[model samples]
Target: MESTKTAMEAFEKLEKVGEGTYGKVYRARERATGRIIALKKTKLHEDDEGVPPTTLREISILRMLSRDPHVVNNQIEMPLTKSNRLLDVKQGVNKDGKTVLYLVFEYMETDLKKFIRSFRQTGENIQPNVVKCLMYQLCKGVAFCHAHGVLHRDLKPHNLLMDKKTLILKIADLGLARAFTLPIKKYTHEILTLWYRAPEVLLGATHYSTAVDMWSVGCIFAELVTKTALFAGDSELQQLLHIFRLLGTPNEEIWPGVSKLKDWHEYPQWKPKPISTCVPNLDEDGLNLLSQMLEYEPSKRISAKKAMEHPYFDDLDKTHL
Candidate 1:
């Protein structure tokens, strides 16, 4: 393996971009080429264990996923900082003497979450065409991941990185992602963020599939149009309630075997509301696509590939983007 120390010396650290469950990200520039990049440094605690599971998983999955044009490119095990150079004092090290791991990536200007928030602050609605483009790109990236047998268990505005100039969105933060094709250990439903979690996950369905990600895509689609999260629930129960309120409480009739999940419980009955009521800015075709993505029955949820073929994107300009 290449020493990360050498790789670290190649870039001039600019500023801290973001932090997540696994590590901190920094914007940096390469000294030789003057190319900008995002550097994610993972701390390996000396006392507890080796590299964290999340970091290991992220590096492994990203190596395969990055082969696709739509997924973010990540160079793993590449030497980063110089060996002789002193480490940045701000990024505290573990008591153990082992070196930290640095994952190099192409820098993106901003994320969809911050972009939406910026528009909201300015009281400006995102252009309809721009929304369509962004959603289409998101679907492409998700489709690519699904086709490769990887499931991005977590998909939200914050995880979608966007280049401000090109408006190209690349799916990032694959720490929670895993392969679903092969027979493996049972999965936990405690994966996705509460707001974008699917009903099956909330009901403690351990053997979930791509439907979990599709449900999140639906929530993100709505958010893009409204500039706000569709289901901003504070807790797991409240999250399910928010989903049920809009999509109606699922019954055995609407979703077979739904009542058999581990976390199943009887709750208040609420009729499904029109999606347009929440995302009024969306057109008929857009609303139809959103409905399919948010289908209560996981099997009934729209796949990312099918979503790209929806009539809502009939006139979308694919040439420029």
Candidate 2:
């Protein structure tokens, strides 16, 4: 932007709120208007060539999708230069002399992760009506992304922001990173809960589709119903085991090309079991949808659009969302 206003000059930091894939997220207020917003500060390395192309692509995607109510407000970079293809958010450098990028976003009251925690702490299940509403909103948002050819890659509760009063859910950190952004980052170990990872990802598939996010949607669906993670695992191997133990071990018959995956291994075999055994609270329609989302074969997995159309969400009003 041409306005010589940097993020520091335009906003006053209120307090640190949370962290994202790349940096510290702070709750701040605009100095001129006092409107509350969240600032995601990404620290750039001294040796890096420049801003990654993926980051620019993400910025454009955010701008395009933010119009959808279920997606967060766009993370517009401050004081950007218009000439270069790389519209850097590099507002200023820190005391340590590392370059910093500030991502401006509309602040919501809380996120789904914290929301679920509060309910869990109180030993209460989220109301059935509330669960249906949230799930519909989630499916609507995911359907929007997939239609645009964007894969969230990571879709855990933490990345889903929510409003306490309205229960508005927005998908955050879309196309953020593979690793290295979070403080405790490790490839697949830390910074990510092993629970929501898709079976194909665990099997080391070289390619993926929106089916991955649907798998996570299924996991989140179960968590919302039961007030706990469906497949809480400590490690990748254990995560796959958690899935297999519940869904039954996959084979050529269940998931074709299962043995051909890069990380495939010979292991225990089992028969398929009813999904309701694990997520027993769901009604028949709900169970059917969840099972489709958790299909072992990626090809058979339900798409977000189809998920939104499922009988499980028959009573939900779609016009408002």
Best by lDDT: 1
Q: Provide the clashing-pair count of each candidate structure.
A: 11, 1
Per-residue lDDT of candidate 2, residues 169-271 (tens digit): 7777765433222232223323335689888778877566677789999999999999889999888898998899889999997888999988899878767
Clashes of 1: 11
Model 2: which residue pairs collide?
1-80
TM for every model, in the order presented, reads 0.88, 0.86
lDDT of 1 by residue, 1-321 (tens): 345556666778999998977778889997889978788877776665656676667676677765433212243211111001112222234346665777778777889999999999999999999999989888877887888788888899888888676677778877788877655447987657988898888988888888889999999999999999999999889998998999899999999999999999998999999999999999999999999999999999999989989999999986544
Q: Give the Å error, residue 129, model 1.
A: 0.4
What overall lDDT, based on C-alpha atoms, would model 2 receive against the true structure? Answer: 0.75
Worst lDDT run of 10 residues, candidate 2, spans 78-87
